[model samples]
Target: MNENLFRPQFDALKLSDKLWLMQTLATRYHLTFKELYAFSRWGQSCTTGLFEKGGREFVFVPGNTVILGWEGFVQGMDKANQEELADIFAEIEYEGSVEGFLRQGMTPVRQVTIGPMFVGRKLEEIGWESVPMNDPRITAHPDWLDALRKLADRDGQSLKIHETVRFERNGDSWKAWLCHPMTYPEFQRSLLWDLAASLPTPDEWAYLCGGGCRTLFPWGDGMDYSMHLHHFESPEDEDKPFDMEEPNFFGVSIAYDPYMREVVKAEQFTTCGGDGGRGICGGLGIFLGFLPCSPHCKPKVQEDKELNGDYDFYRPIIRLENHD
Candidate 1:
């Protein structure tokens, strides 16, 4: 059997032909296909869609050729967006700090071909198999007062976002979450067992976030200052809630916040996004704060100095390459 029958060059197919092919894919693989891209000043948006397995959802990123890295903050992003970002620059310190870092040797540019993949929309939480619960699940628990009290009692007054899961109990059933910093092997083992998926590569992570678009953020180049980016200059600012990890056009949530460094694959032992909340809480200003979301940023993953920091998370992806 041709394993790659599910993968096709969508750009070459005509509109009607595309629809016909999409139908086969839908019926055969339980995948839904959609054309979400068009040619533009920077480039065409990557074709992204959706699929489901194990009662969980995933964003399907189609295969395509794309430029992987670039030189300057304003280089890959088009002119109009450059102008917009410059205005935001005026509100914060530039020359000595963020600008110097940006001006330095940026992520080296090179064209690369990426294959289709299904990316998880949310970070994976561990420890579901322990109790053998029939309906195991995990979700954000902001108002978990009992768990909060227990956490504070065990650790300290402040609510930490680390290994501890805030589990809620019910008769013969329970749910758990808040475990964002699981090691790669731990997540890999669970995910592969559950959905036959694993974490994404650095390049795949880039495509998931930027989708080959020459823009700063996933949606576009300009930043929406209205959304809190986890960067704070004062104690009062820290009080503000973190932005919800919303899905990008590809239906995956990634590279949005600098505080959460998502664990990546390979022998090097590195992460794809974030500085582990260092820049966000370090008074580094807004530019450094939001830099994690940009695909062009170099040294894509660096070692976080803090010990077993709560800033780590995992994003599992199912590669659509030939099983043969």
Candidate 2:
């Protein structure tokens, strides 16, 4: 939120008024415009009548700091450039809306593209409904298994036996983890803020593992053992799952670990980018010269009963509408 005091009024706008102030600050920060059109001038071609309607793309982190396009794959801009690019966006001084800047906590950052559509299979084709909860084929109907066996007999050993369970469908209702015996970082950060209408902070996981390029790993500083990594060349490959490798410029594959994802800022909980080592659960580790997979490592700082298991996974960040 400290975008260097609005960088000289966003470097004195003009590129079509800075693309209409980045489509009016990405719809005042709820962000979801999949395509904004009108570029051309040397940037090749692209002209779809300057915004008529187009939602569900989510990743325009203009001033909440870096991760807009390109690395996330050409999200439009140019339109003949009138000037202004002073460090890519930062002027909208919070006038209201976007749920009042997410009730003052403010957040918007996305970028992790590289290849083989990874961030957990593009958060499962943009609907994110995992719920492996330790597998056993994941059944749940005898009245939700007798209400989870009376919530594991009224929370005995602090529940979370094995844990995995992810959800987020929203049409016929299937949102986050309905509570019951769910605990840890407050019901998995309130079931990932009710299954991703937004919730991926920790500075958007440090701008998607350093896309601002301070380098340590985000495709730099060397260490490309031929791409598709995993336990540094095979530490007894545990069946290797998750996006099968090759992604980083923001498509975000198994970024380096066997599991360790759970990110959020104001409501607390923290852990970021790095997996496939704590005994490999779902392979594909994006090499970063080893050691807690760089990009500023961050191995500890988890407490809400240590979030849960299967490497504590989590990934969802939608916002095509529904500000609830």
Candidate 3:
């Protein structure tokens, strides 16, 4: 009867209850304890009711308690980087040092118990249902192909529905290719609603990416320009692998592209991961552009409020009550 959750996900439960649910699901699915724990502290990921459709995978972020602020990392920061960050903050009109500005609400380095969570995986190639050109959803607009192509991959990668689908513009047998990305917003909503998963909170997100570690990026604080648009800027580099979104320690692709703003579940900012390329895209150079890769980076600006409604990069998470 001790059915209480420590963090609303796993407040509490008697040993029997934990064993019961784990045994029930694992036994029926032939899942081992390690596999069962996958949705939690271990295991890359295991499917559950969360994903109703599509191929977007999910991973388990185990509950943990650690200092979730910049205080623990400031001393190790290089003096020049500190100065650089401070300058960036000053340019943004923040009154204090770069560290002080970042510590605004991320301070106190208190102990936080993030219960085990199942997070949405941002894969390199998510399965999208291509839309047929002749589908009734198609309007009579001749420019639809060009405009939609803008949204698809430019070089024709995973999001490249525009590049792959062949159409003669005014051809008679005009039928479209894969599912339109325009449908992704509505489709993603329904999936989230059905799975009972919501976007990960900043802390939850930070942990998922960096595991609450002091490193800026989940891998390290170093900046790899090859991971940015700079890698793909040249004509000859067109076929090169952008090499973005490598799986993190948890095997979940959260966010890395500075241009692609990722949405998060937070009262403020409501956005994390990248800074919309304001740093590098703004001509500030790679150092600033790569800052958003830091799990702790705060890119909230005046217009960030609109991200939740329009942004496409977001990782949804479901809280499990049996977070042992």
TM-score of 2: 0.27
Stretches off by above 4 angstroms in model 2 are 1-16, 19-21, 24-57, 61-140, 150-152, 156-207, 212-258, 261-272, 276-293, 296-324
- Using all chains and alpha carbons, the TM-scores for the candidates as numbered come to 0.65, 0.27, 0.60
Which numbered prediction scores highest in TM-score against the true structure? 1
Candidate 3 TM-score, true structure as reference: 0.60
What are the Cα lDDT values of the candidates? 0.57, 0.38, 0.51
lDDT (Cα, tens digit) per residue for candidate 2, span 1-324: 323113234334445654665565456544433443432221122221122122323333222234421121122223221112112112434344322322232123345422110122132122124454443444543444445556555552222232333333344333333223334456455655654344455554555444455333455433444444544456445455422243444434434553445444445556555433542332212321243444445534566644444455555453232222
lDDT computed for candidate 3: 0.51
Model number with the top lDDT: 1
- Candidate 1's residue-wise lDDT over 20-110, tens digit each? 6445555555555444333222233334345556656665566767887754445354555446446656656454543444646246677
Model 1, position 224: C-alpha lDDT score: 53
Residue 179 Cα positional deviation in candidate 2, in Å, after optimal superposition: 17
- The 10 consecutive residues of candidate 1 with the worst lDDT sum are 128-137
Off by over 4 Å in 3: 1-54, 72-108, 123-130, 143-192, 221-244, 267-269, 299-311, 322-324
Candidate 3, residues 1-324: lDDT per residue as tens digits? 112322233324444654565445334433343332223322223222222223445544446666565553432455555666667766777776544544553434546667765566672222234466666555555466555555353443222224233332333233444433433345346546755667677777777766666655444444544453542367766766454455555667656576666666654445676666667757655556666766676545434323222233666666665522
